[model samples]
Target: MHEKHKSHQVSGAHKWLKRSVAHKMFDRVPVVPDNFTIGETNDFLKTHIHEFETINYIYITDDTKKLKGILSVKDLFRKNPDVPVLLQAHQDLVVIYPETEQREAASLALRHNIKAVPVVDHEGKFLGAVTGDQILEILNREFREDVLRKAGIRRSHMMMDNILEIPLWTGIVHRLPWLLVGLGGGIVAAGLIARFEEILATNLILAAFIPLIVYIADAVGTQLEAFVIRDFSISRKLNFGKYFLKQFILVGTIGLILGGLIATVTNVLYPDSRIAFIIGIAVLGAVLSSLLTGLLIPFLFRNLRLDPANASGPIATILQDILSILIYFAIASRLLS
Candidate 1:
């Protein structure tokens, strides 16, 4: 049943939360109480320590199996084996409910450097532990999907066997929406490009490098948005100034070098010095505009209570395309006319 849902291809962060098998697994995770105690923390260590290779700490709970506290193995070593129970050595336990957001739960575990933390129900009963390893696995899977998505690859066909082997009709259903969005955005960009036809006609040479200029800006913006969103997902504060300048300088430098190369190539090919110069300037402007767009749109979306990554995808690309077309034309008009 869950496999069917997992077969659906979802774009952005929605894929992990809405279409992932892990999300389904998490939904059914168990819950336990707080008072659940360890009869012998030592005995649990000796018995189950070999069972789970990554077991870092042992939890002690009550008669009802409600988690009272947790004790690290280091605490066990310091105390005498004859001690009735090691419950006193427990520090303040970190517990999360079953419905806790997966990202939040993972972030807390990473922030605290905990090996695993006990999960609990509303009544504070012991559930299971969310291991750091589990979080690591989730991160790895998500990262792969993110990288693939940036390359414009379809994700549904990649992860789940059920998705990859589905009938052509069912498979097309999953792919159609993303293509529709991309197509709609492309048509809008085409209209913007058409609006700039006068400028292109005045300097026909500029048309040669439109793809290069637009792509450079769009790529830079996408990269910046993804970097910021990923860092934001971690503990780092969103440093606007630092992020802006960092992307500005990096994209600016690369764009300058690339523009110089494009200008040189065009000068050799087209035999028009002024057209080449205009193309170079337009390229540089478009690159900067793109970098700024990449940085601002995500932050803007975040302020508007939206997922920044959503702004990082096809919609942002289309907007960037329109902006790049405008910038390129405006630069060409000024420089050539």
Candidate 2:
């Protein structure tokens, strides 16, 4: 198999890779905001612990630069340093950016053996801090969410039932744009049906199978889109060759199997072998196109820095339905003519 073709396959680790590492990994950058600061080591320690609650370190910063000083409970209350401990007293302060990858951040933290690192902006001003515990928690939560997403399961139940607890309104807030896009997709599908009015009028069976064909294609597209979005989101680097090959193989196999089954079933049930074969071929072609659409559409949206899932979901399925109809009719015309 061509290396590029491996990405589309449903076998082995490909699906798992798409589901696990790609879907659920930490991506959000820790930020303390420009206004973040610890006034003085001792005073800040007293107040910050009360605010953030058992915080690891007090970040010392000013309007321009992050002064290198951090005071933990142990440093402040336990064996205090023999010198005066001020905001800029300590010479070492580790800082990270908001856009740093989670894995890389974790690795850095581990290397230094530090519990917490302050986050700073480009100008060296402290934004906030990320603790070792927080990083691990975020990664674990993301892992669960990713697994659930791949299974077509809601994540609310997995970690804390937040998915279950959050009202549908929350999802609606995110899904509203996609839902509108779905409406537009419906319009496009309707247009395709209208264009094929003559064919549907002559063969009612064609109309009967159209919905099923479109729905299956849409489902496949949704699954592929989810996987691709997760991959792009977690790892800014596009592992294009691998994903492409996997999707192609998996989608192609599904198309072949479905097409063959439809052809066989229709030939057995209906009186006309001619219509059955044509419909089978058309359905198969539509399905394959749908899968490809699902894979590519989200990838493109992500490339453009858009929310791939929200932007691609309704549009991909709608376009797939339109394409399916067109392909189905084109094949039908050639065979029936």
Each model's TM-score?
A: 0.64, 0.54
| TM-score of candidate 2 against the unseen true structure | 0.54
Report the C-alpha lDDT of model 1 over 1-337, residue by residue, as the tens digit.
Answer: 1111222111232344442223422212212123323345556456544344244666555667667767676666677666544345465777776665556566677777776656667787654566666677666766766664554446664454376668888767655666677788788778877877887777666777788888888887777777777766563367778877877889889789878988898899999898788778777888888765677877787778665565666667777888888888777777666
Candidate 2 accuracy as lDDT: 0.60
lDDT of each: 0.65, 0.60
Q: Write the per-residue lDDT of candidate 2 for residues 1-337, one digit (tens) a residue.
A: 0011222211232333332222222112221222333333445445433334225554444445554456555565554434344432355666666656454455456668777655555776554556656667655765665544434333344444455768897755533654576688778768877877787788878877777677777777777776776666655676787878887888888888888898889888887898888867876787788655777766776778654554453456567778887788778767766
Model 1 whole-model lDDT (C-alpha atoms): 0.65
Off by over 4 Å in 1: 1-44, 47-54, 59-100, 107-114, 117-128, 144-167, 196-199, 264-273
Q: Top model by lDDT, which number?
A: 1
